[model samples]
Target: MNLYRIAKWVVSIIFYPLFRIHVIGKANVPKSGPVIICSNHISNFDPPVVGITSPRSIYFMAKGELFENPLLGKLLTSIQAFPVKRGMRDRNALRKGLQILKAGHTLGLFPEGTRSKTGELRKPLAGAGFFALRSNAAIVPCAIIGSYKPFRRLKVVYGEPIPMETIRESKTSPQDTANIIMEEIQKLLDLHK
Candidate 1:
């Protein structure tokens, strides 16, 4: 097996016992085709938490600083995570994101751009809109409620897919499109609360 799948297996084994994992609306995930997963970021551990349970391997875009160390960089890449500068508009990240979708793979983006310190859903970033329009990929809205809770039964919910058709029909601006995506994710989290 390739390193990516190998690393996923190893990490999934490790995460299985660490958290009380639960998935909602997972069936909405398409079995194939391009997909973009938009989610709220509550903690640094959120990526790996969702990664282990994801229906397919998801390429994650992370902050550039997280890859400073050589060994850690290799490890992150093994898990299909690459670095992107947070500020100053990261073209590299955008380009890589489009490529993933073009190749018919899944890509996960934390629309808030940073962790939500207050555990509330912040407005999503514009990059989400850019990718959705450029790649014409189906967007999956996901929410991880209770991620900020300490030692509690954590819930990670995946909402239904929001097809590009819906966005286009609504005549949404690219930025507003990102907002709509996050709103759906928020609704799911609110449903469980």
Candidate 2:
């Protein structure tokens, strides 16, 4: 198996039991075609949790700091994770994200740029909306419900795609589309919590 599959298998073996992870609405993810999976960030475990539960491999932009450690960086890269400088506009990272989407791959994004210390939904950054509008890809709002505490039931709920037409008709800017995405995420949170 490839690195992504191997890593996913290992993570599943370790995390499924430790966290009691539960995945719901995975069928909401498009089996093929370009797609963006936008989720609320809670803990460091969020990305891998989403990755393993997802029906397809997801390319993620991890914080640049994580890549400072060469070994971890190599491992992350091997599994399709790239580093992105947070708190600023990183053109290269943005370009990479668009390229992934234009190439019809699934890209995972934490709309809330950073993990929420309080586990509450935060305002989404503009990148997710930018990818959605620019690539016209399907946007799947996901929610990671429950804390990462051991033996606790953690849920990864995938919601229905937000139609491009709806976004285009109502959202004129990246932030506007981002707001809509957050709303969908919030709904999933509310429903699942």
Candidate 3:
């Protein structure tokens, strides 16, 4: 098996039982083609939880600092996570993300630039929307509903795909598209909470 799949198997073996993770609407994910999975940031565990539960392998856009450590960087790269400079726009990271999409691969992103201290949804960065519009990929809105407390029921809910046509037809800007994506994620939260 490839490193990413092997790592995912190991993580699933460890996390699923420890966290009592529950995945809902996983079938909503497209089996193939370019996809952007946008979810709210709650904890550091969010990325792996979402990744393992996803039906398709996802290349995540992670913070640049996480790659500073050589060992950690190599591990992350092996698992298909790329570094992105947070706060200011990083054109290189954006280009990498676009390239991933253009190659018809799945990319995972947390719209909120950082994890929420209060576990509440924050204003999302426009990167998600920009990626969606630019690549015309299917946007699968996801919600991670529960804290990372061990043995607790932590759910990863994947909502229906937000059609690119819907966003394009609305003529929304990149930021607006991001806002719409958040709204969909919020709906999943409300429905499952």
Candidate 4:
């Protein structure tokens, strides 16, 4: 009956068929809890793929440019996306993200900051780890395979949840934690190939 649920259904129903998305390891997703879905960015389509495939609402930090269309922006906001400066502090973006996580929901993040042109995994931006650490949310390292191509058979693999305690116990800085998550995502992609 609410707008967010309606928007989520519309997006998911429209996207899943067009993309032919294959979601694996969804069992790894906590049925109920705050989670950070740390992912490998491959294409512009990546965010929609993750959002539709998720069993729960997942928020992502979107580029400010995406909200240029007032109508589309309203729809995106309904499904849990908000704008943030791509490479700047963008305090508003950061606040929105943290607030989403703190409110006990999944917040999607591409640690790489942007898509990888070669479909190869890139070093994660420091934000992923920082947000997880700061929010104390479990990080679900996810890998989206073959999305670099338009309308391809995209596979999204969800690895085991990386506990916040493990991240802190490893004695790695937030940047290092982000890198570790990225590496784990890359390995998952390689495994499916």
Ranking by lDDT: 2, 3, 1, 4
**Count of clashes, each model:** 0, 0, 0, 1
Which runs of model 1 end up more than 4 angstroms from their true locations?
A: 148-151, 169-171
**Ten contiguous residues minimizing lDDT sum, candidate 3:** 163-172
Candidate 3 regions exceeding 4 Å error are: none
- Per-candidate TM equals 0.91, 0.96, 0.97, 0.89
lDDT of candidate 2 over 72-175, digit per residue (tens): 99999999999999999999999999999889999999999989999899988998888888886889999999988999999999999987896687757999
Give the whole-model CA lDDT for all candidates, comma-separated.
0.82, 0.93, 0.93, 0.81
lDDT of 1 by residue, 135-191 (tens): 867889888877534446677788788867867867778789888888888888789
Per-residue lDDT value at 21 in model 1 = 66
Q: Which 10 consecutive residues of model 1 have the lowest summed lDDT?
A: 145-154
Score residue 13 of candidate 2 by CA lDDT.
100
Model 3 scores a C-alpha lDDT of: 0.93
**Using TM-score as the measure, what is the rank order of every candidate, best first?**
3, 2, 1, 4
Error of 2 at 141 (Å): 0.4
lDDT of 3 by residue, 85-110 (tens): 88888999999999999999999999
